[model samples]
Target: MTAPTLFSPLKFGAFELPHRVVMAPMTRSRTAQPGNVPTALMANYYAQRASAGLIISEATQISPQGQGYSFTPGIHSAEQVAGWQGVTRAVHAAGGRIVLQLWHVGRMSHPVFQQGHAPVAPSAIAPNAKVWIVGEDGLGGMVECPVPRALTLPEIQAIVDDYRRAAERAAAAGFDGVEIHAANGYLIDSFLRSGSNRRTDIYGGSIEKRLRFFYEVVDAVIGVVGPDRVGVRVSPHITQRGMDCPDMVATTLLAARRLSEKGVAYLHFAEADWEDAPLVPEAFRRDVRHAFGGAIGVAGGYTLDRAQAVIQGGWADWVAFGRPFIANPDLPERLRQQVPLATPDTSTLFGGDARGYTDYPRTA
Candidate 1:
């Protein structure tokens, strides 16, 4: 039998995807200031790229406390929900499927964004990472992350409730589903890793305890949105940002098994795409396939050939592209026609106007 190609149609959760090219979630930090609301410009940006099988919207904070970076949109308020409604309506009008990526950036934050309070984490540990903070001069710069306060049990429960409310707001905003941002050294990631979570309470210690917060958030989200509408993004191998945990792979496998039992729609693996980053192990992929029977998606520095190869190898059901989608809104079509892609301006990637966000040209 001929193997499935990247252009093959497949059923993903509640949507019938026309292809397997997914737009990976990206944080552009271009939301409306003073409220972090999604603007019409941002709606236009997503609407232009609605041809993909699926577009995972940028990482959005669940509440004021979840805001780790400057100008990232939030889903906790009425205005924010209304703002997202416009974006979702635009995407759906263009015949596309999009989901919100719920995020909380644990210790990967600065006090400037936290109302003078320290960021919260599984333990009182500081990530050796920096976050982008925009100064009063309208310039954005990377600021070092400081030691965070350990989240108490009640506070942890509140965050899980926050995830639930976020999911509720996502559905109200007309999203097709939601992707839990449990990766990239974020809140959930810290709770899942031993290197960052040194607590001896029920929220830490062994792998089971370490996963308590993650599972709670997942269950809370699923309660609001059914399992079929839930997908999780995990980065077991991307060990940067003080996330170098030796037991991460094993922990991810366990997560896969448990998620399989929960019947979540998909599991997305966020791989390190840098030139010198280590390659994801083939054995780990095979192991994940065995553990999680749901659809799998992977994102990294994937070219057309690489994406097709992985799908044909039965490692992933879909392949997500990040930077490619930024500059080439019609990315799947460009890959289909074998056209050259336009490179995105790195300078305008974070906080910018239409010059780079919505002004990228498509082939004539």
Candidate 2:
């Protein structure tokens, strides 16, 4: 039995993976209502796709203050922790490892989600992006983001404490590890890119200062679960939601090195997934590989051949599949057997029932 194309084994920290396929973090907005919590439906959803080497759960808000979207799960409350316990057990029962992606949307949030206060961030800049929120009509609508109030030093300490607490909750919920969601113009990503962060305090103005929030967050999380069980996801080339900046690549690479020094288990790069998205330059990947001596995971519109080329040549240790995994529960097996992938139902992608969430059929 020769090794399968992209089905090679990989060592992601303490765990040994049977294959190098990852289920990238994606927000499906199917969590239970009233208080954002995971459900049995989510447990079934993740268990069906347990073939992946690792499963990074949807972006989960750390605290009430971290929330920015409707129907997204949180890890702060007791109910939320109990809710995720089911999901983690289901994945583990199916013989898979899973991680929760901790998220805190900064300026991307509307005042509605921020409890009538301006969303907080490293600086008082507007993202000029919109976020999904349920309005007076009881329907989800995109609302313009408000200019976030800059976080004071004490507030910054509080947010870091929130991340640490969230990590503790994830461990209590039985997660294999935790991934910091610092990409796609969220709080950490905003602090890293100069376009979004315009502060003159110790938290901004220079590359090192701009990265202070992220470093502190990572340090806090590491204090909770150790560095080997933590991963950081970053988006260097994404042009989405006013996050693109001239200094994006340089800052991301520098942040990657700092994460490596923190002894992070892996660096997950969220490559551009849109049509006509900018390609991740070879030079950037080469630099990242040399600078970060840990596992590298890449995701964004990748096919089997592209994944094979990267992993086979040592450019990345694994490849994460996002949308494809939504419709194909047995994605890794299908890819290993060269089966055609099922098309995703984008209509039911968010804020829906199990129709497009857990109703996908398992392949033979």
Candidate 3:
């Protein structure tokens, strides 16, 4: 097979992607203190990888209350906005198109990271798993997740407004667009899954009701940046953070259909768990594509060959690479030229300095 099928030009939303390869969002936890603002080093990191067709930034909090871990960037403050402006300017100067991923961790937060406050969620249920958090010893560490308080109706509405505000900030900071983080057992995913949501209110119970918060969020974000500049991510069956749906197939199809009718830019689906997990079945991928007529990006455990096959088979318009891109800054060039990729240093993945963040050299 010929190399560079992944490098073919493609149009996604309002931007023309230089190639079908995307730098998928991965949390780096490298922001500054007090406000968790983006740093100058971060700007340099993104600028170095500007060759990517599209750069989806690491998950950024929409509000102070939305934070689940310490040192992750936020978009709700002037300092944070100004800090990100530097990043966006650097990326654009290097000829890269970038989008900010708006995120809220919901119940996946420890009280220590919450600034002496309890984390909020669709219900007062605690996750059955642990969450990564900063340790008092100053080194990066992990801790057990605290039980979160269920948000009142008014609180939920306020969160929607926060997302709207975050989108405005992203646009002002010069991002090409904004991607709502509705996947991976986050705030929106909490509501979508029956296991995490045990509320007896308008935002819970039936699938339609569970989807209400996400739809409202989309409407709010679109209001701020318009529908053409918005995108949403969904993880149907990754099963992370204690999230599971009784009917994964039906729920995913319904969510895709609803999002398609909304006229957003694109829908990103994490078809399956990436770590030693089965690939998404062919029938399910086709079903999702049929339900969602607009552009689709499939991620999670995709190699160069599998990515090309997915696009050629008409299953997805784009394929996002996470770990591969981490170790290879010139991932697209390497794939196109069939060059060997560098091994990623897993020890430096999270809460690291410039070492793992930007020290990855390109293929010579």
Give a tens-digit lDDT track for model 3, residues 13-81: 687898898989988888988789999989998898888888999999999888887689999999999
TM-score of 3: 0.96
Put down candidate 1 lDDT per residue, 110-199, tens digits, no spaces. Answer: 888788999999899899999899898999898899999999999999999999999999999999999999999999999999999999
**Between the candidate structures 1 and 2, which one is better when assessed by TM-score?**
1
How many residue pairs of model 1 clash at the backbone?
0
The lDDT per prediction is 0.93, 0.89, 0.87
Q: Positional deviation of 132 in candidate 1, in angstroms?
A: 0.6
Ranking the candidates on TM-score from highest down gives 1, 2, 3
Pairs that clash in candidate 1: none
Deviation in Å, model 1, residue 361 alpha carbon: 1.5
Top lDDT prediction, candidate number: 1
Model 3 off-target regions past 4 Å? 1-4, 273-275
lDDT at position 56, candidate 3: 92
TM agreement with the true structure for every prediction: 0.99, 0.96, 0.96
| Lowest summed lDDT window (length 10), candidate 3 | 270-279
